[model samples]
Target: MPLNIDFQQIFLHLFNFIILALGLYLLLYRPVVAFMDKRQAHYEELDRQAAEKDAAAQQKLDAYDARLKAADEEIQRRNADANRQLEAKRQERLQRAQEQADKLVEEARKAAERERAAMLEGAKKDIAEMVVSAAGKLADKEIDPAADRALYDRFLEEAQAAQEDRP
Candidate 1:
């Protein structure tokens, strides 16, 4: 009314603009926003699944490490047991060898003692026979002090000869 503008035409243009905005909001804008929300949800699900798979892999790694530790401990225990058994066997063999050596030494000492006893007995018999022979020869002659001395010297010579013959 003030600038000679028509009120009916202005009202018509304003109504047309409002209708176009409403149509775009319902058709293009709403569909694009819904598509973006859907894509975001899909990506979130993929991330959650990946986290679960990583947790499972970590659990498997821990299990394998535990198994390896147990295997190493078992190997050490077996080696210790084997070493102990070997040492025990070595000690037993050493003890047996010592016993055998002691037995041999004792037997040798006993044999030497028996031989010495036999030699002493043989020396006693020879001395007794020499004494009897000297007495018989002295009885056949006069036994002066000089003759007694001479007989003693002869007996000493025979005893020395017997000693030389012994082993």
Candidate 2:
């Protein structure tokens, strides 16, 4: 409105503002942007490393799990084998014990039978001798050992009758 209010001063102020803007862009803005870009790149690299570490850890864990599973299976197999062996041993022991018991029982039975047969044979011989002595006493004479054996057989009938009368 004043026409002479100093146009040169206005132009100089605009030039100074443009120069200030250029200086700020070159010195502060670009450096700040570059520093921010570098920081972002560093963070990206760290993130990638972290991802790689996580993947490696996961792989190790998987391997450990596989090994544990295999160990468990092996242990189970060994236990089963041991159990089978124990059962077999138990059965074998039982069989041996049974065989020994059977053998002992058979031997005892045979010994008892032999003892019974011997007792019966001795009793028969004693009866025969008693019959001969009794017949000799009844006849009031000494008997010839070999000649009266047939006559002594008659006493066996009387002995059997006496046994039948006993309760």
TM-score: which candidate is best?
2
- Of candidate 2, the 10-residue stretch with the lowest lDDT total is 158-167
- Candidate closest to the true structure, highest lDDT: 1
Off by over 4 Å in 2: 1-14, 141-167
Cα lDDT of model 2 by residue, 87-148, tens digit:
99999999999999999999999999998787678668767877677866768855676546
RMSD after CA superposition, every candidate: 4.7, 7.3
Q: Estimate every model's Cα lDDT from 0 to 1.
A: 0.93, 0.86
Writing each residue's lDDT as its tens digit, candidate 1 over 58-147 gives: 999999999999999999999999999999999999999999999999999999999889888998999889989988999999969998
TM-score for every candidate vs. truth? 0.59, 0.73
Report clashes for each candidate as comma-separated counts: 0, 0
Candidate 2 global TM-score: 0.73
